[model samples]
Target: MTASNHPIVGILLLAAGKGTRFTAAGGEGNKLLALYPNSNGDQVPLLAFSLSQAVASGLPVRLVTRPDEMEIIAMAEQFGAAVTLVASSGSGETIAAGVCDSANWAGWLIAPADMGWLRSDDYVQVAAALSSDEAQARMMFDDMPGHPVGFGKGYGAALSQLTGDHGARQLLDDTKLVKLAGHSGVVKDADLPAQ
Candidate 1:
């Protein structure tokens, strides 16, 4: 059966963070809105690059962003993601909103929007692996945990009830994980310009 025949494992692209660390470190504005180099070395908005990767997964993508981020909203729409606006910029809040918005989906792959280094194929592979299993999963590159963690269908309520900045870390601790190795980009994020 094709992907459509299976229950959807939607991508919950989290983009509502305040990015205090980035800005405090001398990065401009919302880090997601800052221009960053893509794999091809072309400059594009950081969130746009991450959204591109998530959309390329061929899974349904629902992005949670701040209402003030019009540029990020436009980029998400352009990339074909269903957008949900949240007042709070907390990571947990963003995840909850996105997961609740996509509540009917069979599962969710929660991806941070600042991780511009990720490739489209990374999302694809993670979705594929998660679809074949019941356990939660995460990508590990060079033995380091990374973004776009996969939570199977069973964790919807726990995920929806999440709050604060701790975005799924506690819930993940309560469950077993299936770690898969992938490109080093999984461990890279745009928290700083040099990173």
Candidate 2:
């Protein structure tokens, strides 16, 4: 795709975090590497599923991962994403690195790496909202703002200011946010494995 199509919104898929919870649950290594059973009853790599969605989205995608995560970086590259290796800093730093040059796009879509179950078209819908007049937008599932949050170019400074676990949430205050209704995948995130 040309820059024109992706000029509206770029996808920032954060994957640098060490999945401590997953490791604690008797699952070794990164939770992203843990095999999860899919709908078809076939085990799939969590990161791979997530990476494939970002690739199928057709948006200009950047995968932010730790320098040690060579496997994840390689997989991300295979899916046609610009992979960026960070210092394994906090979530905020990972995001900042992913959107280092925000001026090229109208907005940035913050998609967490663990949210792989979201449908491909969901990415397209969220992106469409960014190109509109909305300065900031997010998926609304069950009456709450959820993941895959899209922030317009006007919030570039705030985005850049992110440093810890904080993300675009701080900027939502006192601002009109466009909420697009989405399914469960919009809010679903892999925190701890199921009991």
Candidate 3:
């Protein structure tokens, strides 16, 4: 969708986590940089997979990562996403920074950087929910809630106020939560180097 048609909704790609588990699982490489062969037989970085999905959704994208991750920034930029550097201490800080940067957006579709399997249509569904009046917050999941939750402009203030390790969980509890059909990729994360 074009910005003019859905001026309120924006895509926020959260990639600032330290990936401690991944480092432990492997040696020193950032899990996002880990290469995996796709069905096409071409090796692709884990982060690029997620980014490709985001771009396919056709939403304006903003990538959030730590200042030191120039590689991540370059990769995201190559995929045509605007990049923002934020502290990687926790999800709360990274999300808050993303929200602060997207303050002018009417709503946001937040996606975790590691969720490589999230389909483009999944994002489309969440964005569609945000376009509706009843969806204050939309979560994508099957058996349970998962990543890439959508938040309307109404919660921008609360999202911006987030601190510490807290995320949008608190806001979801306070607003009208809409649960969409689950996508298996939503639960997939590069928790380990081998994963």
Among residues 3 or more apart in sequence or in different chains, the pairs in candidate 1 whose N, CA or C atoms overlap within 3 Å are none
Minimum summed lDDT over a 10-residue window in model 1 is located at 126-135
lDDT of 2 by residue, 1-195 (tens): 966754567788889888876667676777777778888988887877887887788877888889988888888888888887888558888878777755577788888898877766777787777755346777879996677888778777667768887766677743567788999888887777744
Which candidate achieves the best TM-score against the true structure?
A: 1
Q: Tell me, what's the RMSD of every candidate?
A: 2.1, 2.3, 2.3
lDDT of 1 by residue, 1-195 (tens): 767666788888888888888988889778887887666998788887788778877889888988988988888889889999998657888888888888778888888888887777777767766754366888888888987798888889888988999999887743478788878889988778655
Provide the overall lDDT of each model, using Cα atoms, as 2-decimal numbers. Answer: 0.82, 0.78, 0.81
Backbone N/Cα/C clashes per model: 0, 0, 2
- For model 3, the superposed segments whose C-alpha errors exceed 4 Å read 1-6, 132-134, 137-141
lDDT of 3 by residue, 96-123 (tens): 8988887877788888898888888778
Better of 1 and 3 by lDDT: 1
Candidate 1 Cα outliers beyond 4 Å, as residue runs: 1-6, 131-134, 173-175
* Each prediction's TM-score versus the true structure: 0.91, 0.89, 0.90
